[model samples]
Target: MSNNRRPTIKTVAARAGVGRTTVSRVVNGSDLVSADARARVLAAIKELNYVPNSVARGLVTNRTNAVALVIPESESRLGSEPFFAALIRGVSGALAESRTQLQLMLVRDQAERDQLTESVATRRVDGVLLVSVHAEDRLPGMLEEMGLPTVLAGRRDAGEQLSYVNSDNAGGATEAVRHLLGSGRKRIATITGP
Candidate 1:
């Protein structure tokens, strides 16, 4: 019997005839739980339509089920850049479908860069999505060395070892140029990210 009201740990616990702590442990994926108890908790959770509060669960298990979007650039660039905005929208849209939180990190200086590195090294985020890859950026290497699951928006011409997703800027540009040139344009100009 579910309504507009959301189910909580207490609801699942009561439905399972167990303590809230037991339900919490099960929801947090604690291996210490007994198999029989785990089954009951899972059944109860399903019956009650209970979705564990990730933030609350994060407090106990230290996994936020969240990802950090680390942009190593200026705020002005993010504000003015349509590419960044569109990429972020796509990222957030996809994440929202899965109920994941996005932590935005802007690294503008050496100190901020160091802080970002330390925070990631300390496991503050489950994963990281790095954007604005410069030719000589060190963050990607540092993140990879730390064993973090990282995705890059774009890579330098030398390419990156980490998984990444990006628009085919080069291919797109070439196609656009070909289109324009085919249409009888004598000159074409393209703007590329730095």
Candidate 2:
């Protein structure tokens, strides 16, 4: 404990006078372990101050328990947009209930996009949540082709195929236009950004 060398599971098992599997089962809280072995492992863990490595456990379990949130916008835009902030809050709240870690990545151009694609390709995350829907965006298609689970905060258009979390922007626009027409506005225009 003082030599700066980390104590491993094997060391704990040795100190506990039990096999490695017994220690593993005890650490995992498996009922397969007898009462006596569990007690010994617990005592050894305390004596060594051993901590379980969640990352290694994730490797064995095939679940990193993490998801990526990709925002195709600059940091300035992210800070300025209330909608994006609200989207992040909702995403965070949902993930907190499920006990999953969220990794936020900003992809404003091709270079950043490529980096994101590589990270996903390496199986570093379980899934992706994309924001900033654009007509020319290629990330959703690329993520689908790479076999990674992907979703959108919104959609490029009415015909968007990816799963999305969105409100009724079209309906709201229609209601606003109707109100303007009834109020006798001479000219009304809806401008979706180009």
Candidate 3:
């Protein structure tokens, strides 16, 4: 029977009279489970209203079910930049829905960068999300070669080979200019930042 507290895999295992590993295999849809065990596990899941925690499932499957958001920027930039906040919010919001945890990595210098790279190499995180990479940055290539899933907020350049999402700055500027010209403005001044 379920109560106010949530049910875990162990609870389901006890109810099903199977080992935790067997329960995990069944929950993860591994073919190693036998017919009778699968049936029992399913029954226990239904009876106890068991909701498999993705984090626990990841542990049994040799995965952390966690992602690292690596931002190679100093505290100043992280504090001042609006994009970083927005990026964190968007990623965090989506991850929250899936019960996956996020590890924020703000690498400020070479020492921290080395540490972050070491963590990635040690398989501490399931995947990496890199932001604010320069045109010549090699982190993306290194991560890909290491066989880690990676995503970038924006590309280094037009010839960037990695998967990335880029802003349409030029398109937006062109549209602004066209809007002013269409409105019969005699002159339009463009302002930019350093």
Instruction: List lDDT for all candidates, in order.
Output: 0.86, 0.87, 0.87
**Model 1 ranges with Cα > 4 A deviation:** 1-11, 19-56, 59-62, 174-194
lDDT of 1 by residue, 1-194 (tens): 54988998988998988899999888867898889999999999897879988678888877767799999888888999898899789889999998788888898899998888887877778999999978788888899999989999877765468898767867988898899999999977766568
lDDT of 3 by residue, 5-65 (tens): 8888888899999999899899888999999999999999999888888666666787887
> Highest TM-score among the candidates is held by which one?
3
141 Cα displacement, candidate 2 (Å):
0.7
Model 1 scores worst on lDDT over the 10 consecutive residues at: 153-162
- TM-score of model 3 vs. true structure: 0.74
Model 1: lDDT equals 0.86
Local accuracy of candidate 2 as per-residue lDDT tens digits, 61-92: 67777899999898998998788889888888
- Candidate 2 residues lying further than 4 Å off, grouped into runs, are 3-6, 15-17, 25-49, 97-99, 168-194
Q: What's the number of clashes in each of the models?
A: 0, 0, 0
Ranking by lDDT: 2, 3, 1
After superposition, candidate 3 runs with Cα above 4 Å error: 1-10, 17-22, 30-56, 176-190
Cα TM-score of candidate 1: 0.70
